[model samples]
Target: MFKTIKNDLPASIVVFFVALPLCLGIALASGAPLFSGLIAGIIGGIVVGSLSGSKIGVSGPAAGLAAIVLTAIGTLGGYQNFLVAVVLGGIIQLLFGVLRAGVIGYYFPSSVIKGMLTGIGIIIILKQIPHFFGYDANPEGDFAFFQVDGENTFSDLFKTLKYITPGSALIGIMGLGILILWEKVLTKKAKIFKLIQGPLVAVVVGIIFYAITKSNDTLAIAQSHLVTVPIPEDTSSFFAQFSFPNFSVITKPEIWIVAFTIALVASLETLLCVEATDKLDPHKNVTPTNRELLAQGTGNILSGLIGGLPITQVIVRSSANIQSGGVSKMSAIIHGFFLLISVIVIPKLLNMIPLSVLAAILLVVGYKLAKPKLFKQMYDLGWKQSVPFTVTVLGIVFIDLLYGIGLGLGVGIIVILLKSYQNSHFLHIEDKSNGKHKIKMSFAEEVTFFNKGAILKELDSLPRDTYLELNLMNTRYLDNDVIEILEDFAVKAKERHIDIKLVSKRGVVENPESFIEFFRTRPKSNLSLS
Candidate 1:
């Protein structure tokens, strides 16, 4: 791992800059103390990164969990009680790992997974736009369609347009320009450029801009637009910020509900991130999902015990880590250390960095995730892949992340069913010497309602005086809908002078009362078409 330092160190620096604002923003969005977000980031990086099996994935306070955390805090009567649930949630996740439930992540269709990453990319860009313009009403981590403040995502954007801050907007534009120059120009320079990253350079320039603006009242930016790290007056005051959980609420039903909710959502988010990060990795490293769940579970427990919000393998941070050239887990671990040391040692220096600078860093990340090439690539894969991918992108953009994913998954499943129905059976027609046509129809291994359409089409297309032989010898399960369609076709066959013969493992039946019931009476056997 240490051998990756050359790449990991620079990547870690980039991830650190990207993570700073997010840590504070997630805490703010959760309505928890601002320091709590930093705590989660620190723990997510250090504890989780050290334990995680993922090579290039980064963990942190997730925007996906903001709503759950907010509600849990209020329902639990205090943030401390919610912290207890977080810890318990982590324990549950750890148990899930031990139980080997992490394989569940593998079951999601590829289209849905791609949709998720693209959707998250769009959301990150949209969420960061306000920060880019210095509109701080909504917290940096609010990604839901409906914000806790009662403003929907679009309404919030309109609000930002109405209340843009000049200082924030200017700084943001300058930061974006600096980043663009560093990437498009300075990066080509061998010596100095390779030594520093664009995000780091942008941050330094933003700090200087902030310092210059701070000296003049007329050009001053409000404190809200600046990075707000909690400044403890002294060591004692700093230590006072950490809140311990109220374990007395451990037995309450509400605590368990919150615990289960966190465990389920965090695990799901982590699995999704693991899938997304694996795809993002240039080396194509396949992360061990079960191990990742165990690692996340342990990390969440630690985070909650130490007064941090729930942690997950966050896609935004992970994508940023990958884009910044992180090759190993060391980059993630080091960024966590950066979060820890920055808060304890030089929070004032951290505060000097502007939010606009960080927004510029995320802008690059957002672009990389939702690049035009990705869209074109998916489109080229055909409608089966493209439709779901498009729906997912739009759903996430116009709705919420989870809802968008669900929509994409629904579309993907429908596509699969359509394909299955079309391919369920094969029909071959032959003209017999006896002045009749022999039609052979073969059924698939498992026929469901989805296969009914093609089956009906084939049945209805049969010509008069045709001798049809329906084969179900390989079929294991036939759905009720398909059976009904067959029954209706059998009845209509007599009128059309169609002679029907049924063949199965049991034997051949000249005429059957019920297609499904006839099969039910047959001896059980392994049925496979192939």
Candidate 2:
């Protein structure tokens, strides 16, 4: 891992810059102490990063958990009480890893997963737009369609337009320009540009801009529009920033309920992000899913003990790590150390970094996730893939992350069912000879009761005085209901003056004794038409 430090170091800096504001934002959104978010970020990077099998994935305090954290904190009576739940959640996630529950992430459809990434991308761009213009009414890291402040996503954007801060907007525009230039030109033109990333430069520029504009009354950005890390006056106060869990709360049944919820949700989000990150990884390395859960469980346990919010492998940070050329988990570990050291050493300097600059950075990340090319690519894959993809995107943009995923999964399942229905079998009619139509119907690889209606309709529509061929060559599993249909159809075919020929691996039979009897008598391999 140390061998990759050359690559990991620069990538870590980019992730550090990206993770800083998010750590603070998600904490603010969760109604937890801001320092708690940094704690989670640190543990996620150092502890979880060490244990996880993923080379490119980054773990941190997830925005996805902000709502749950917010509600759980209130419902459990206090932040200290909620800390108990976080610890318990970690224990449960460990159990999940031992049980190999990581496989659940594999069941999510590709369309839904892509939709999720795209949806989040769009959300980041939309939510950050307000911050980009210095409108900070809604706290950072609140990505829900309906914000806790009672304003919806779109309404807030409209409101931001009315209260745009000139200083913030100017800094944001300049920061974005620098980022774009760094990616498109500077990185290619010089080695130095590759060493110091665009986001870091953008941050430095933002700090200078804040200092310059402080005296301009009309153009000055408010402190609310800057990165806010809790600054302890001294070492004693800094040590006090860490809070212990109220272990007494563990006795409460409600605390366990909250723990289970966090475990279930955080595990799900982690698994999904792991999947997305692996796909984005240029190495195409597959991370051990069960191991990831164990790592996350441990991270959350540590995070909770130190008064941190819940932790998960976040897609945004993971994607940033990959895009910035992170080659190994060292990047994540380094980023964690950055979070640990920076908060203590440069809290005041960090506070001077404009929120708009970070917003500009996220805007780039968002654009990459929701690229126009991706939309076109999904659409080209056809409705089966596109519809669910579109629904997932819309649901995420208009609803919260999990709900949007549920909606997309529902649509994806419907598509699968519809495809199953339509693809039950294929029917072909040969040219008529001597007033007798020759029809061959082939069953699919797996025929179930869901294919019953379509198969029955085709059988019933056979014309009189025809030779009907029932082909089961490709079928691997034939449902009993479908056998019953063919058996019943055999009897009806005689009445219609249709001669039936049964084709199977055994041999072609002319008017087989009974469809069910023939199948029962033959070996499983012989029962399939060849």
Candidate 3:
């Protein structure tokens, strides 16, 4: 792991810059104390990264959990009380890992998973646009369709025209230009260019712009448009910011309900992020989901104890890490250390880093995730893969993360059923022999009841005077309902002047006594069609 320090160090700097404002923003959106977000960021990085099996994945206070935290804080009476729920939520996640519930993440369709990453990319772009132009009404981490700032995602874009800050927007455009130059040109020119990433450069330029333009009203970035980490004057004041959970509220039933909700949602988000990050990883490393849950649970427990929000594996940060060339978990660990040390040391300097620069950084991340080529690639794969992918993207862009996934999963299942119905068998027709229509129908590898409708239709549509062959040579598992259907069809064949033959690895049996018995006694084999 240490061997990749050159890569991990630079990646960590980029992730650190990406995570700082987000930690504060999510905490702001959650209505928690600003410092709490930093605490979660720190714990998520150090504790979770150290324990996690994932190399490129990063954990932090997630935007997905912001609303949950906001509601729980109010419903549970106060911030201190809410901490109890977070702690309990961590416990519940630990239990989930022990129960091996992490396997649930594997059940998602590939189309849906792709849709998720693309959808999140689009959301990131949309969410950052306002911030990019220095319209700082919404928190940087807000990813939902509807905003806490009384604007929907698109509406926010339109609103940006009315409040764009010239100074911030100028710097944002400059930052974007620098990122493009570094990524598209400079990095290929020299090894040193790779070490000093574009995001770090953009942030430094943003700080310099803020510093030098302080006297210029039109070009000077406003304080509201800059990073706002809580600045402590001394060590004691910094330590005082950490809040301890009010454990007395642990006995409340409402607290437990809140805890369970947090655990379930956070685990789901983490699992989905794990899937997305692993796909993005250049190394194609697999993360142990159960272990990830354990790491997140441990992180959350520590975060809550210190008055921080619930933690999850955040796709934005993880993807940024992967995109920035993170090779190991050390990148995540170092970013946490940065969060820990920076707030205690150079928070005043951090405050000078304009939000627009960070917004520009995120915009690049977003563009990569939702690249135009991906759309064509999915479309080229055909509707079976594309439809759910499209629906998931639309749902996520129009609704929210979990809702989008559910909608995509539902569409994916429908696609499966449709394909199942259509693929029940391959039918072939031959010239009439002995004044009878001859047909051969080969069953699929696995025939389930979902295919009953198609098979029944094919059998029912046969000519009155016909000879039909039921080919089981390549069929593996035949459903009882389907076998029963064939049994019924065989009975009706006598009246229609249709003769039926059962063909299997056991050999052909003309007018089998019982379709069900014949199939039950037959052996499945890799028999090629003749």
Candidate 4:
């Protein structure tokens, strides 16, 4: 970890800048205290990082849980009650780790995962637009179809256009331009810009701009565009920010429901991040899924206990970690430590950073995740991959993240089934021997119920008086449905004066008496020939 630190410190700084605003934004979206998000970020980085087996993955407060947290708070009666659910959710995730359910992440198709990332990228860009324009009526990270204010996503964007504040918009544009310039040109120039990070520079410029405009009341940006950190007047007031759960409510069924909701969503998000971070890792390190779950579980438990939002291994933070040159877990740990120190020691200075400047930084991060090249690459993979990928992307953009992924996974499974059905069997015809046409039907490996229709159709199409050879030597498993169809075809073959040969591990039979009974003689595996 120390060796990794020397090489990754620069990247860590960049990740720190990238993570700071997102932590606050997610907290705001969850309707929890702003510091709660920072707390999660710190714990996710420091605590989870130390426990995680992943070399490159970074953990943080995720946007995906914002809606769940918001509703859970209300449903559970208060934020403290929601903390109980989060802690329980963490315990549930730990159980998942112990049960080795982490392999579930590997089963998802690559197309669907890509779609998820793209979808999330688009959502980030969309959600940040309002912040860029200084119309922050909704919280900084809300991305649901319907918002707490009763307006839908598109409606909020349209509403923002009509009420754009000049100072905020101008500063936002300037910040974005500076970010772009830094990435495209300044960062490449070692003499002048190597020592300074673009996001840090953009933030400093925004603060200066805000201070300059403050004197001219007409040109001033509203408080909405500025970063809002709760300023406690004294040590006692700061400590009072921590909330405790009413454990008496734990008996209520609603608490269990909320706990399950958090567990499910948090687990899914963590799994997805594990897969994504594996992809992003320069060394192509495979993170142990179960270990990741355990790490996340521990982080969430700590976060909940400390009045923080639930923690997940977030792709956004992980991607930033990778891009920032993080090679080991130390960078993640340091970033978390940075979050803790920033809030405790210099929160006022943190609040001086403009929301628009942060939006600019995220815009860059979003583009990296959903680059046009990714779309082109997926398109080249053909419709089987591209269709699901596009569907997931659009679903995430128009709907929600989980919905989009579910839709994509459904489509991907259908495509797999279709391909399997297409390749399940092959027919060959040879010259007639002794005045009968020789028909050969070769079955594929592992024939399941999905191939029943196609196999039956092929058998039914054979001509009368044909000499048929039904091969099951290559087939490992024949589902009961296909076995039944084969048995029915055998009776029809005899009636049609067709000669049928059944080939299996056992000697060939002229005409099987009973398909199920013949196969019963042998050990019952996936495949049995009567």
Task: Count the clashes in each prediction.
Answer: 0, 3, 0, 3
lDDT of 3 at 449: 90
Name the 10 consecutive residues with the lowest summed lDDT in model 2. 521-530
Question: Which structure among the candidates has the greatest lDDT?
Answer: 3
lDDT of 2 by residue, 447-511 (tens): 88898988888888888999888787777778778877888887787789989887777667777
Q: lDDT of each model, Cα atoms only?
A: 0.86, 0.91, 0.92, 0.83
Query: 1-530 in candidate 1: lDDT tens per residue?
Result: 99988888889999999888888888989989888898899888988899998988999999888988888888789999999999999999999999998898887788888888888787778888888888888888888878888887778778889878787788889888888888788878775776678788788888888888887766577888888999999989999999889999899999998899999989988987898889888999999999999999999988899899999998888988887778999999999999899998999999888787788788878887888898989989999999999998888888777788789889988899889978899998866847779999998889987888899988998889889999888887777677778878878988998888888876677764554456555444532222
| Model 2 score (lDDT) | 0.91
Off by over 4 Å in 2: 522-530
| Number of colliding residue pairs in model 1 | 0
Model 1 spans > 4 angstroms off: 432-435, 460-464, 471-497, 500-525, 528-530
**Model 4: lowest-lDDT 10 consecutive positions:** 521-530
**In the order shown, what is each candidate's alpha-carbon RMSD?**
3.0, 2.0, 2.6, 2.2
Each prediction's TM-score versus the true structure:
0.91, 0.96, 0.95, 0.94
Quick one: ranking by lDDT, best first? Answer: 3, 2, 1, 4
User: Which wins on lDDT, candidate 1 or candidate 2?
Assistant: 2
